[model samples]
Target: MLDKLSLVVTAPEIVLLVMACVIALVDLGVKSRLRGLTYWLTLGTLAVVAFAAADMAMDGRTFYAFGRMVVSDPMGNWLKCFAAIAMMITLVYGRPYAADREMLRGGEMFTLALFALLGMFVMISASNFLVIYLGLELMTLSSYALVALRRDNEVATEAAMKYFVLGAMASGFLLYGMSMLYGATGSLDIDEVFAAIGSGRINHQVLVFGLVFIVAGLGFKLGAAPFHMWIPDVYHGAPTAITLMIGSAPELAAFAIAIRLLVEGMIPLAIDWQQMLMVLSVASLLVGNLAAIAQSNLKRMLAYSTIAQMGFVVLGLSAGVVNGTTANAQFAYSASMFYIVTYVLTTLGAFGIILLLAREGFESDEIADLAGLNQRSPLYAGIMAVCMFSLAGVPPLVGFYAKLLVLQALVASGQALYIGLAIFAVIASLIGAFYYLRVVKVMYFDSPITATTVSAPADVRAVLSLNGALVLILGILPGGLMALCAEAVVRTLAT
Candidate 1:
């Protein structure tokens, strides 16, 4: 049912899919050590797609294609652009690590990441339940393979298995919820579901039950508390490069789908879902920060930290309404979007430093692995410091502004409970800062474990430097990004 006109709305995805296939095929004729050819091609393709996404975002034109199953809008385009760029950075940072470990035997990493980006594109544009689920499956399937790419490693294999089982269960929950929603609303289109529920003629009990399952599934996907059992093991066990890939861009996709399913499809059920998200948020903050304090492994610590950051994102979502006014909807959702984008930006830098520290036969998963990093390379140490401090909500950094916006949105809701959630958020962030600061302390104060120079390839160092610069620059002038997010959210909600 796809046609030429459909391609216009999905041009970036179409181009990316074709290039991924081309890169894979081209890799077959190249020597093993020359895999950099495939890597460069992948990066080139992603750049083109990213530029296309940026163009679409600027256009701010909403166009529905494939019989309204999907739509291109500013919000989706911006997310796709960010996701593509994030994946590009992921690939750039991942290649040397992959090559060092002999995992670059093929173009599997690049192709799979491209396909995952395509999946994210689909998820962002999807306006139908089945389409969003299809995109989600594509992304998750690719990720599962990427995690297990180091097939010879026992830890990677075990992590892949755990990820598969849990991911499948989460998908099942989401699917079941979708089915119940379809039964109650008698439509699979997100807009139709919204209208049907807004009419207040539906079976309230069924809708509420479905909402519970959907929220649970989303929590698992976002690594929220109680459903976050898989993250620590998976992050710790998988290759650091793969962990970085998993951590960065996929989060943008997750945020897009959350907006699609919750804000777009089920706004009429906001009250029920808000309460559900509130519980998940509180639990995630408590579990993630407290548990992270006990972890020595950097990956596991960041994994738990991911859980806590997701709580803040969801907290913003939960505060979108107070007393059913819907007046704060735009500001609230935009704050969540800003938080997710900035969080992913900082995550890339954090994980990039980890990748930089990795060498042959050595995985830098331990907190102590960063000892004397500042003395070894102040440039990288400063980069890592920026990321860690940003995550800790330190002032004059992007993460601080992100957290501040969320808290402001919550407080502006003027509900005692929501205000209390803001206080809880502040307290949790304070408690969480210890681990983040501890990483910085190790980098700065701890004596060197190994005196080897922290060296990386030219491209890696250059791009990483730019990445770190963007984090600080954005923090210093967060207005442009905040405005973009606000505009995108407002445009999407208006349509």
Candidate 2:
């Protein structure tokens, strides 16, 4: 029922979708030698979308379009902009790696990635539960194909199958929850459901029952513990280029959906979801850190670390409402937004380095593969060290500030349990720091596994350096971005 005017809010998504289709068609006429056209076209599409999102966010436009099924707001727009830019950077860092591994035999990677980005756009802006699920499926399906792009690789195929099965189960869980909520409230629209709950007196047992399933589904998507069995195998078995594509940008979308579903739609039931989130957070922190310590593979270790880092993000979410007050909701969620954004930024740099170092017949996935990196390429070694330190929550890095703000939100709650959780988070972080430092030590102290000179495309090197500098710069002066996040959360939540 959406006409052009009614759907204006989805302009960025429309452009990207059209671009993806056009690129797919054009790819057929181009030869392999000219496949770089597909890459360039994809980059142009991303640039246009990201620019549009940024401009919209800067203008502070908020729109509810297509009969209120979707929204255009600063928070959604900024997240979309970040996702597009992340995809652009991922493509730049990944092209050479994909080419080396023959994963670029066609233009599927570019088109599929574009489609995945489209999915993220929808997920970010969706105001309907059905829309969110549609977007999630689109993204996950594209990711499945991307992971198995190396169709001949048995491991890649195996990982793809596992991802598909697990993703299906998670989707089922989410859909079932939605059905339960619909049965209770008789609405699929998030706002309508919120209003339905608000009109009621107290707790709805049926809603609470649905909440558990929804949290389980969200936990799987976020890669939190007990539901995180897919992350390590997928990250390890997929091509590193594919891993970068799957890991970095989708996280921002995941965070956006969490805000939409939990904060926007179900704040009335925070007491219930918060308890579940706390358990997931603690489990993720303990399992992610402990499991990571045992992994020799860099990608797998990062997978586990992702679980732990996402735990911090979840921890921030858990602190949003305290003592039946929404007073701290904005701050807690804003802190989580800042944390995920910075974490994604840091992750882009870390994984970009791994892709650059990878050569044909060598995955460069093992931690020992990075030995003597400083001797070979001090620039890269330094970049990797910065990322490792940031992930470990070392001071004067953005990650530390992210954790500090989240912990501050918890402390401000004056809740003994939250305060204890904060202390536990610190201790877990301390335990996790050892593995991160080990990577740095290997880069600095250990001898090379091979004496090959490390090199990357000029653009990859330039973007990576900028990414590192941004993390450090943001850490030094976290005001602008922090303020931006707080403002976005305040405005969106107020609406």
Candidate 3:
């Protein structure tokens, strides 16, 4: 008999689960005029969860539960820590927006966020297909509800519907793939499937078909090309707070899921999937970058940027597995992980600035809205500039190092073509830079069309400042985080 109680070995997940239940109960029973209470409680819980995760990281134990459906290791631990911290930052950036719009009191937002975080924890640690599916659905359902929280808004409703339909399709694809894999290998566990593949017991045709569907499903989640149609509308239409969470947490979860699926489950067939990923990477890079150049809405542009970033991560994963060198592979994995971290920081910072500029009747989502921002508030302008520069992969910024590491890993693996493609990617990044810089130019050079005013809460200012500064600090002193990434990649590969 499986011991349900033995599943949680780390305090982080335990604390999160307990807090989630308590928050649900409180929301059910209590009604208070203190609209911000739920927000604070959510923030506090996530903060404690992050601290617990950090403590567990220091101890460094791998945990397994429910007959290996859940497996926790360094990589999962670190990603969970990132997720918690990101959630806390989202709360900080979002509180004022919610309050100003009179959308603050409902406990559903915070409760759903906690539930999503719990799902993320499970997603990262999932060692079997069933667990992965369960986690993915939990996160997806919560995200759908979150997008529709502003129920009266037509855009929010439309975006939520699109997200739901598309997300369900992706889930169906994943389920079909899992079923095929089970038919071929007679197992639901990733390790067992991999073993079957390695032992030559799996049918190659069935495996390939399964992998195709799986990649398609994951591609949808990562917002890569061909499956990226929903990104721009969703990002643009969703509430900025929900946008921040979707932009950051879910991307990290998808990356972790990709690592688990590709790195572990498909290792025996790396060559096959590597080629597929390369095609996806190239398509995403071209489509995402080129499409972003034409966007006027900052949020939509960022949505495309997310797509391009996923392409870069896919580039690393493709190179890592195709060349069949674990060291170089891990190096590439670390680069991808580092890139995701930097992207999260940059994206959140950028969105934080956007949320600050948004008023009840007006949303500052258009690039032109930022004109003469430097004249309005130099500090806010400066922070936005830093975010823009980081996203553009400017030198001495964290994004540059991220790209450099991926390129270096590709070169070390002797994938000259991929190196050239990465160089092309750099050029595309420069093209993407034009819009980012245009925002800066408008902020510093162009005069405002109307009187511009900045009104953000102190907590938002502090969190945004810290987020912007940390990107630069990590950019300058990237060795420490890079080392940690390397360690995480090693542990992931060892498992």
Candidate 4:
């Protein structure tokens, strides 16, 4: 049984769920191609939700709600706040493109996005295995529909089918692992599972077997290598707006769940999981960077780039526990948090530009499409360049600082193996830089395919500018956000 207090802990999710339902009903009357009324209402709902989540995070309190099925804490609240804001920006940048492509004919995109964001909220707050699976399914299902929203397009339909099949397989892996753990531990609550494992009385071999399956499932969700087959196809075949929607904020939720399941629930098995994560990290970097270089399709290239970036995140996670001691846990986990947040920020800007360039009859999704962008619209060109440079780990941008933090975490462990991993990550990053710089060079030096200036809706322009500026500004003064991540992780770990 739940109480009013439990509902209070999930107030933001409640408001979101209610507003999403209302907007869906209200959109039935929306005749505008842009779904203006639905859009504004959705943004308003998200704004309120984000603000409320931030306020709750500032309280720095932790509450176990719904019989410990969910949690409300600084880390979860902050992630919810960021996810909400990211969805709002996605809508702003995507509305025009959706209108151009007739993808907003039913306002389903907006409603589905809200639902997906709500799913992220649930995942961030989950403290039980069932709750986490429920949230993951909710988010992933909405994404599948969104990918298939353009029903007339064979490419989108194919992408949706592929995503559905692979995602289902991955979910099964996760559930099987959870069942194994539950059978061994006699409990599904994360804390209880941790207690059971730490007691040193469980079947170690069974735990290890379950852990292998769990990591594989998580690797698929995070788009890490050896399990990344779905990403490039999905990103390339989906509408650009949906691609951005899929690419950006859900990552924060994934990172949150990873921390909850692995670090919080299974730290006693650190030695085993860390080794698994190390291998994933190495494979992701090598495969992602190498594959991205051969890609001429911008979306597919970015998809592979995403895998490599996730590798850095996994690196940070693998370094959290050293020699069975939790001394560096906070710093290591916080570094991963910082990296994912900044990566999401940079991704939004990069994909925003892609959405802007795509016209009614033109996809504009190839590297060649960006040729001579500077000659037509320097503002957008500069924004795109900033994003490319940031992704390349260029200095004075947020990406450099992000990579630096992860490397610092690795080196802080003072282990030769981690140090070797860090060195390998750097080499992979350097290889990745070549492809990223190639995009910049084409934008600046290649001949123009069109002399017309890029035009965007006023809202999109303003949001895109703000998005790009934040990447640069955050790079220059990253201390504030870095400290915020550290504090959130500290509070989360304390509970």
Best-matching candidate per lDDT: 4
Candidate 3, residue 60: the lDDT equals: 65
TM-scores of the candidates are 0.99, 0.98, 0.96, 0.99
Model 4: residues with Cα > 4 Å off, grouped in runs: none
Clashes by residue pair, model 2? none
**lDDT for residue 313 in candidate 2, whole number 0-100:** 96
- Order candidates by TM-score, high to low: 4, 1, 2, 3
| Residue range with the least summed lDDT across 10 consecutive positions in model 2 | 1-10
Q: Taking the tens digit of each residue's C-alpha lDDT, what string does model 2 give over 1-495?
A: 687755578899889889999999999987874377898899999999999999988878678888899988899999999999999999999988888888888899999999999999999999999999999999999999999999999999999999999999998988898888888988999999999988885349999999889999999999999899999999999999999999999999999999999999999899989999999999999999999999999999999999999999999999998999988898899999999999999999999889888953588999999999999999889989999999999999998999999999999899999999999999999999999999999999999887788877787889989988888898889999999999888878878
State the lDDT of candidate 1 residue by residue for 60-142, as single tens digits: 87888999898999999999999999999998888888888988887788889999888888888899999999999999999
Q: Note the Cα lDDT for every prediction shown.
A: 0.92, 0.92, 0.84, 0.94
Stronger candidate by lDDT (2 vs 4): 4
Residue-pair clashes per prediction, in order, are 0, 0, 0, 0
How do the residues 1-495 of candidate 4 rate in per-residue lDDT, one tens digit apiece?
Answer: 679979999999999899989999999999988899999999999999999999999999999999999999999999999999999999999998889888989989989999999999999999999999999999999999999999999999999999999999999999999999999999999999999999999999999999999999999999988899999999999999999999999999999999999988999999999999999999999999999999999999999999999999999999999988898899899999999999999999999999999963598999999999999999999999999999999999999999999999999999899899989999999999999999999999999998888998899999999999999999999999999999999999999
Off by over 4 Å in 2: 3-5, 201-203
lDDT of model 1 at position 198: 95
Write one digit per residue (lDDT tens) for candidate 3, span 1-495: 356534455457677878988887777654653345676778899988887776666556676777877777778888888889998998788767766665555678888899889888888888899889999998999999999988888999999999999999999998898899989999899888888888986679989999999999989998889899989989999998899989998888899999998888878788888888888888888888889889999899889988988888888888775455465788889998988888888888899888888853578889998888888888889988998898888889888898888888777776678778778778878777887788899999998766756867778888989998998898999999999888887876787
